[model samples]
Target: MELKPIKTRKIYEEIVERIREFITSGELQPGDRLPSERDMAERLQVSRASVREAFSALEMLGLLEIRTGEGTYIRQVNIESVMSSLTWVLYMEKDAVLELLEVRKILEVQVAALAAQRANPEDLQNIEEALKQMYQDLQKVRLGEHADERFHFAIAQATHNKILIHLMSALSDTMERTLKVSRSKLYEGKDMPERLYKEHALIYEAIRQQEPSEASERMFAHLAGVEASYLV
Candidate 1:
């Protein structure tokens, strides 16, 4: 019987997996001190640098906390927060950002429709406030990306879907970065910001009038416009 060669993995990644397994098996617990890097490196037959890299990654994921001049310890895990952090790392690539914009088109179009159907007075007010902020930013010659994010988030909140809100929260960082890049490029053209504001205004009006189809259409058009501008 012939066996295929084993797939090679990064040493630091393998170290990360081993520690995660220890945590999963209850061998590691919150506030529990980890072995010194030298000890762990010797035990695992890897370089101390690999172990240190793994520790740094774990610290970033909130699985481990490194105190200066002290031993590393496990931290209390919040799965959602960990997942969000992971998502942020995973979507840092240009291709990933473009794919996320595609996903935004799919998700937010539906989200706008839902908002139109379910939004209360307070939700409308929140969206309107975001629009006002966007307009103010435009007047000040700012990118207004944060206001744009708030506008989309307010629409998501209007949906009242807990899972959707959580998904949006997880994607928030990547989404913000994506928008910043796109808006910077788009704003190179004169009147682009005003055009964007008009698109948002149309979407808000459709939602305020409780027209789900119109809201969805306007959302799709707006996202398509942004994507077109980004690609240009």
Candidate 2:
């Protein structure tokens, strides 16, 4: 996790990765101010533009809090900030949010499938409780969505795979804000809770049945509907 200087063929990207590693490894902690832009360029032995672009990328991820005339500091970690910025990735002017959704489909469908096969009795109980909370909060659609998000997050934690959890966490953070925004715009303001409750119930049942494939399908199907309803 040491922030080595960029050495790869794609120099700029390597620089970006190294900078990320610095924060990841605690070489730079939250609220820890970074050396000046010029200092970073000189220390990393890269052009100033490279440091600027890398810092910009990190700032967008909420890794670095930049203040005019004050300097840049490591910001506290938050996931949705990362994902929201990732949503803007465009290739040749074509929207890649759909591709991002597909990636989420792959990761989360597998997460649900794993939760079905591997989730402990306690995990099942927790998920059910979360579902119940969601059901009760249906009258408060925003509350329901919050509970719903927690229910799925519980499933991810149940897997007990630290690396997988970290990876999914990053991905989840990226879409979380958008998800909330879209939910408010499309569902919370209307009759969206019923459908959401139904969808969560379907997934919950499949997990309770310990049917990994069924659980995965339910999750994927739910996400597909969500994408069509919101991100698309």
Candidate 3:
């Protein structure tokens, strides 16, 4: 029932959207072959180049499969790929990295509070291990970025929320890049990494003691420090 007549400069993009809608509306199904580019162009009254570009973009988005000597088929979409693409899109937006930190503060502050209440012995042990690794990495004159990430992820694991875990995982790559940028700036001052380690220690202790309020406060302070460091 939706119209697909091209009216804009970005004809290919509109074509892509129409195809996506078709798939979403159950008009198209996985493994169903699509009309050839020439045929589609003729049907839509658009250039073959526009149709080809549309198909190519859809393929990149994991929406379509184009096989030689065959035809285009709707591929089984992977939600992870869609999530990754969205992250990349956000990464390219203006002030997007800073926006990412704001989002991190929202998710991680609550995550810390929940972790404090929900963590079992094994979860606590994992959190402790990550903190210890941070210290060890610093002693070895390394940045310990991986350890820092593990520390946050360990807290998320303690929350026992599968959806939260997956959301965190989806954003982890972009978050790591943002963290590296922030850490580089923060580490320029004397003893800054040491100070950061202390902050982590405080957060770990709060969670270890199962103090939800303290854990949340410490997590908020830590991220605020990170933002101040990078944005300043």
How close is every model to the real structure, measured as TM-score? 0.75, 0.63, 0.76
Best by lDDT: 1
* Model 3: pairs clashing at backbone N, Cα or C within 3 Å: none
Please give the ranking of all candidate structures by lDDT, highest first, separated by commas: 1, 3, 2
Clashing pairs in 1: none
Cα lDDT of model 2 overall? 0.74
Segments of candidate 1 deviating more than 4 angstroms: 1-36, 39-45, 65-79
Give the per-residue lDDT of model 3 (tens digit) for 1-232: 3445677887987888789879879998889999998889878889999999999988887888999899898998677556655554555453677788788888999999999999999999999999999899889877777888899999999999976776676567777655666666566567877888899899989998999999999999998988887877
Candidates 1 and 2 compared by TM-score, better number:
1
lDDT of 1 by residue, 20-86 (tens): 8788778888899998999887777788898899899888777889998999999888866466555
- Cα RMSD of predicted structure 2: 7.7
Question: Candidate 3: which stretches are off by over 4 Å?
Answer: 1-70, 75-82
The TM-score of predicted model 1 comes to 0.75
Better of 2 and 3 by lDDT: 3
Please tell me which predicted candidate would have the highest TM-score against the true structure.
3
Residue 77 miss distance in model 1 (angstroms): 5.1
CA lDDT of every candidate: 0.83, 0.74, 0.82
